[model samples]
Target chain A: MELIKVTIDNKVVEVEKGTTILGAAKKVNVDIPTLCHFKLHDMNIENKPGGCRICVVEVDGRKNLAPACATDCTEGMVIKSHSVRVINARKTVMELILSDHPFECLVCAKSGTCDLQSLAQQLGIRKIHFEGKKSSYRLDTSPSIIREMNKCIMCRRCEMMCNKVQTVGALSAINRGFDSVVSTAFEMNLKNSTCTYCGQCVSVCPTGALTEVDDTARIIRALADPSKTVIVQTAPAVRVALGEEFGMEPGTIVTGKMVAALRRIGFDQVFDTDFAADLTIMEEGSELLNRLGKHLAGDKTVKLPMLTSCCPAWVNFFEKQFPDMLDIPSTAKSPQQMFGAIAKTYLADKMGIKREDLVVVSVMPCLAKKYEAQRDEFKTNGNPDVDFSISTRELAHLIKQTIRDFDSLPDEDFDRPMGESTGAGVIFGTTGGVIEAAVRSAYELHTHKKLPRLNFEELRGLEGIREATIDFDGLPIKIGIAHGLGNARKLLEDIRAGRSHFHAIEIMSCPGGCIGGGGQPLHHGHSSIIKARQAAIYKEDAGKAIRKSHENPDIIKLYDEFLGTPLGEKSHHLLHTEYFNRKK
Target chain B: MATTEIVLKEKQVQQIKDICKQFNNESGELINVLHKTQSLFGYLPSEVQVVIAQELNMSLAKVFGVVTFYSYFTMTPRGEHPIDVCMGTACYVRGAEKVLEEFKRQLKIEVGETTLDGKFSINSLRCVGACGLAPVVIVGDKTYGAVTSADVKNILKEYENK
Candidate 1:
């Protein structure tokens, strides 16, 4: 390690290779307030990376204070993390930043949770300074996220996380210098990006600049409607995240408490999204085989690397960036969309409920899902199938406001048939989940043999890129899996260049998949986000007895009664869909 | 994809006109019209994008974000000079970043900003399908793999003269 000698407040500190002055200050407990610098990938408390001038420090003999987060510590470098001069510079910078920002944090949705507010309080910034040009961004209500560009600090943590950690590049600095806004390439809404509804961006945001569109008020109205019957479905990721709002561990499985909480919040039925997740595997697996067979027979030229469509963000990404690959997207709609379609169609028929009368509310772990609810694809019989979608964070708040003593609530189970989920369904909360779940069903259906190993260890990891080869029946199927947008680019490029020999690939927009979704409860750019979410997914998966989607008895009955079997003609039309080759 | 002639068709122009009717200020909605036109036609031809300015009462430069900021909306007729530089994390760290900065210095334009000539509209892309070849730059139809700061002036000159 290259040793760098640094002096802070006249105290000498030695730090190692490639370490920044701010990083070195952190070592000596020299607390430097930073507004722009943050570490999006680091899940630890002290690991957040640097960005703004708030963390500026005096470097011995340097002309101006370099941003501590970006400036590297050097040998024989004299640094002052804090001083009267440093404090004034930082305070002035804070005042200047606050000048351009909206002051409605108290009345804003992010009041208690805002990083800017917390930092302002820490710095004791009381006086209003220079008033600059206030941004006027139309509050985009296009399904997934509510982006108030006026509230944006341009710390670039969201863009960095979305572009770097996730590899989605759904967000970026869209303009030059001061006029820049972190936006998708056409100032399009988040739902327009191949944003997987994994609400990871919302989780990392310091302000309400990026937030899951709050549909709690809408859901409440739906539940209170005297003529309407409201049905709720909770994604597996929700169970893992709900506990975070209540001061519980990130990975705590609040499945029973979650069910009880939703019921207490006034839902007529509490169905599990895991049930639909199982159904997705059965349908997607069959769809994959049919496409593969078609490709092998020269019957289809477009049916290769059938990208998983369940990830709304990834779906949006493909449609926007690589529209020609639409033919490659699985015919299967996302589990959320599939659930909404089936809840209105199959479940509505069995319950003798009118499709118009049933208000299907989904408790999701993603914000992009809220956008997916309104996409043109989700509609079959018109009237948006999923009436409202609230994130796990919003659901937790609604539950807290409605259900007092939620922790003391009795363990409850999701209603049967539509509520019953397999181990494969539970795994859907994590990355490599759909691929793993599909493998279990496909291997059995094609080879007439069990998957043998419970852990598909090859496909499970935190890397941006992962590749695995499996021997199923008589074929050696190569598989690739990627979590986060960055990884997706690498994996997709391989396929585009014809260097990728993999038959299938799984891509999620978040780092740790759905458990680390964009709309989950956020961390302060500390490093614990992914680790906490991953622990939650694994815990949920371990707790399940029957893990494979095909093993779910309800799923068996689903095929036995309505769909016939996996890959059947009916499954393709009702459950699956396609994509378009977007223009450059 | 809709051609320039098709975009100018009564139905398409009428649709853009209809969209302008919804917004309170038609000038504010010019970019949206440009976006619609780009959606209709794959790229934003100067003539068509100018139609947006004429219809919405905004300047041609005012629709820059709608024309260039979005990956979906293209300007300068696309195929003429598809100069793209990789700006992804790995590429940025590997120094395609410096090359991109130098492109602005050399070509007198920024990432999304096109040249005055319009024959060489430079764009910095997010990892232009070439990561293994670190610090990658693509000009027109050719990939000028593994570029550096020193390569920027030569690269621009190569495109300019060509």
Candidate 2:
């Protein structure tokens, strides 16, 4: 790595040869606000990547203002970080981005905290000179987040975050020129496509263009419906990330308090997605072992590489984009779906109540969860499984609206029975959570011996890809874990190419797993982003005494009395699902 | 890009069921059947509205009503080649508008019309998601971002050639 000399505001700073002016400036704390940039991600440079003109900075003596975020700071390069020319150019960029923006921030789900809106205010460009040419497209309310391109600034951050980081091509610059709109394939409704509502797009959105549709009030109304008993469930990822909304630390253990807060908000019962996560492990693990056993016995008809179906977004991607791989989707329902499925049947039958009277609502860290609730196969009790799945952001909005002081909501505990979950169940919230949970069970199942250490450190980290080689029985079992969809796409393609020797792969649609879910609470431009989200998950997992799913008595009781067995006929009918074959 | 693959469920389907119930299960209203089925399926999927037409005792031409009359409906699957002609004010003033008409003429389909062979679908876009580059056309994954009438031949040829 050769260092190249570069000039910035007349200061001598040597830089990496290909480092951009903005990158070099960040080293010296010369702050340059950006709307089109993300952590470890870069904008897509399709046909010279222009038109955004953001990060535009004036290069000394160069007639054109260079986009600092995209341009390389060369040797002997004279650069002005905030010159009059640069400020004027940046002002124009801000104005252009806002020209198309709806400016509907107050009522918007991203109100008071949108990237584009905040940048416009900072730029002191108060007027909209360009009322952008509008498109005929409607909001794409796919299974995940909503797409309001009308408020889009064309920063392509979502495209970059989704395509580059996630490896899912859910969005792209659809039309061209001034009339263009950010869309998913021909201006189609999201419900019709295979979009996993990971809510990653919402995390990167600069404006209200991409947001979770505000369903907070709907949940509130459902809770108040007297006729409807709203049973609230939270995914393991939520407890670690929800604390960020209250200015508490990110990844902080807010589980007890989260359950406490939901009860305060008037829910009859609040449960954990981890309980269902355990059920998923039991079922998914059995499915994997069954397939593995059959494959070892040379049963070619059995599905190999039983793709984890915990992440609905990844499932949609597999079904819609790689339909041939549909056969391998784990029949076990996702934690959220399983929560609702069990709540209606197992819980309902136990309580001796009609399924219709129970309006099961789940609070999750995902947008595709909204789609998961609407799945055709989830009608195990002849109705929708989880009725309303509000995102983590939506829950934050609800708390902000009702709670007197969100930061001061005293810590509390989740309800018993369904709420109680083991560390293995809690790990389900993060990437590689399922694989770790399964490894514990698979090892015990194969060897008939209890493993000592619960922590599977090899499968944990921020890496885009992780692999592990564990000795299962006498055979070395290979496994791969891909967090973001982009990595999943590469792995799947390799599998399609018949080269990957791995037996099972754990894939999550979002980077950093569900804590980085699409529906997490919003934060300041970058200041309020808690760096401790990952540690929080592992820390909470460490706090629990029980780390294995099969060890969860609630899940065990559910299996012993109601479901009977993992992958059993009754369990398949109630807790499993099928996938459709579609285009890639 | 997932939108290009059109598959309708409950909502678009309600139209057919609603119309059937409207006619008191009359299998004789062939014209009504065509209109209802086409309107329901958003340009009939091959035998989807075809099956509906047969069940309703409706003629294929009548079924073609809801499909052709409304711009939303399509008969064959919309073309895999999406020819988006940007006619935003800037591009419209810059000859992009007339270029679009010429494209329809060359492709043998009107604006919002897909070619008979299902190879091309012509849609007049307000903007090509790229404002600076006026008069753009997106053919599948490739968008001639800053397009012009002069560039139409090259753009059309690429899709036609492919």
Candidate 3:
């Protein structure tokens, strides 16, 4: 690789050729403020439209200021990052942006965390020299995301995420000039569009323009209801990311503290979604083994490479984009929905409470879980299995609202039965975890052998897509795992083209499974945070006594007492769901 | 306004597919394909863009973005007799804004909108290379020079009920 020397802010630095001015500046520790330029290093994801001129730096002898984010440095390039001209131009650009933006930072949902607001404060912008009519649009509230396009600064990060990253096709830059804003087709409601409620757009948005629909208040209201039995289930990914909201280090595991917080927040029960993750493995594993058996017997009709339907966004993606191959995915409901189903059915029955009176709330690291809870199929009659689903960020807010010192709280165990989970179930938080959990169970069930080692480290990584062939007593059962929906699209295309040889595939919509999910604490364009969270998940997994989902005592009891057996009639009705063709 | 359904003919659909194929079905050629499709069909509707997106293997939102980004492309159908009211700097200084408003009032439609009867559609153009004829209003192929607010009513009368 070629290297180029550049002088930024009188500091000489040598960087690889094709490195952006922003990259070269970082080598010498010159921090340049930027917006509309986001890159998750090692994930092959970047959104640099060069639309925001806030990161402009003066190039020596150049007539125009170059956007540091998109401008590549050449040999002997002289860049003045904090020159008088550069500062004035940057502040002027910010003022122009603020001129059209609403001054509602005091009450905005993205008040402190907003990238644009921080940039304004970093640049010491106190007054707006340019005031103009701010463009406003109708507020769109979907099941998972809220689209407040009026707050949009035209960064196009969400547009890049929705189109290039996730391939959801739910948002794009529409109109032109001063009236330009990102929107769906005809500015239609996102629920009406092909949006999977993935929330990757919300995750990448720099302003309050895109956000998860705040369901904290609804959860609070449920907690306040004296007649309602509010039980909260926290997803595995939530534990690692929830601590970030409380100013804790990234990847700090706060599972016990989160449980204690939920209890103090007035929940009747605090359970782990990992338990339902175990239940999912039980059902999905059985289904996979049954299919593998049929395929091994030369059953040509059986769909090879059964896709994991544990991700609601992934399910919605295939339903809309690859409707013809809907039958290929395992029908097992997601951990969130399965928890809801079992909570409202078996747990409700055991507690002797009416299903209508039981308010089952889920704290997930995903925004799609909110949509999944509200899915019509997950509801019985008019009552949804899960009454409300809140994000990890919301749980942090709830912890704050409860006025308890999260730092000083005693580590408490989750309530009995539903709280019990194995290391296999807890790994569901990261990419390749769900499939790894399945393989742990499927390997033993198919080959009828207790393997030498439990941990399948070969299946684990932060890669977008991975394929591994595990020997089920020399049967060579191939498994494929894709984290982001874009990667899933590639694997799906290969499957459609008859080039795929995998027996089963695990697909998660977010980049790094639920840990890097949209509803998790914002990663702030840092890939290391996601990597740290993944490491925490593995650490939590290694500390557990039972490492396989099938070995969980609670899950075994549930199957023996309530579910009867994996893929049995009762489990099928409650834990399985069918897909629809949403191609329009 | 609600988009009315237009059942495209087989030949027109084939032409759109062929246009996309001409660009080798690459998503990067979205602008060119949209331009050709818009010129061929007079407008780029959602259904038409959906076809182009499928052919190009791109998302519909992206296709919609390219279609809406350029002012040259539109989703609404153009009328048989399209009216262009120049809103260039010279035209605006020459009271083109008032003339444009008068046309809106007379036609009972906003700029870039067509009449209910599908006879006349109004548009605010930048310039027709006719700054000499400042505040110009072009109806079909004929240009009315130095048009005023009062001239808007007569311009509509020429294309009315024809």
Scored against the true structure, residue A162 in model 2 reaches a CA lDDT of: 56
Task: Write down the worst ten-residue block by lDDT for model 1 chain A.
Answer: A42-51
In candidate 1 the C-alpha lDDT for residue A105 amounts to 78
Regions of model 1 farther than 4 Å from truth: A9-13, A28-30, A42-51, A129-137, A161-180, A183-201, A292-302, A581-584, B1-162
Cα error of candidate 2 at position B9, Å:
27
In angstroms, how far off is B151's CA in candidate 2? 25
Candidate 1 lDDT tens digits, A407-452: 8999999997789987789888888878988888888877887778
TM-score of chain A, every prediction, order shown: 0.91, 0.93, 0.99
In terms of lDDT, the best-performing candidate is: 3
DockQ for model 3 equals 0.61
Would you list the C-alpha lDDT of every candidate in the order shown?
Answer: 0.75, 0.74, 0.90
Which candidate wins on DockQ?
3
Question: Each model's RMSD to truth, in Å?
Answer: 13.6, 11.9, 2.1
Per-residue lDDT of model 1, residues B88-162, tens digit only: 877888887778778778778765566666666667677666788878878766788778899877776766656
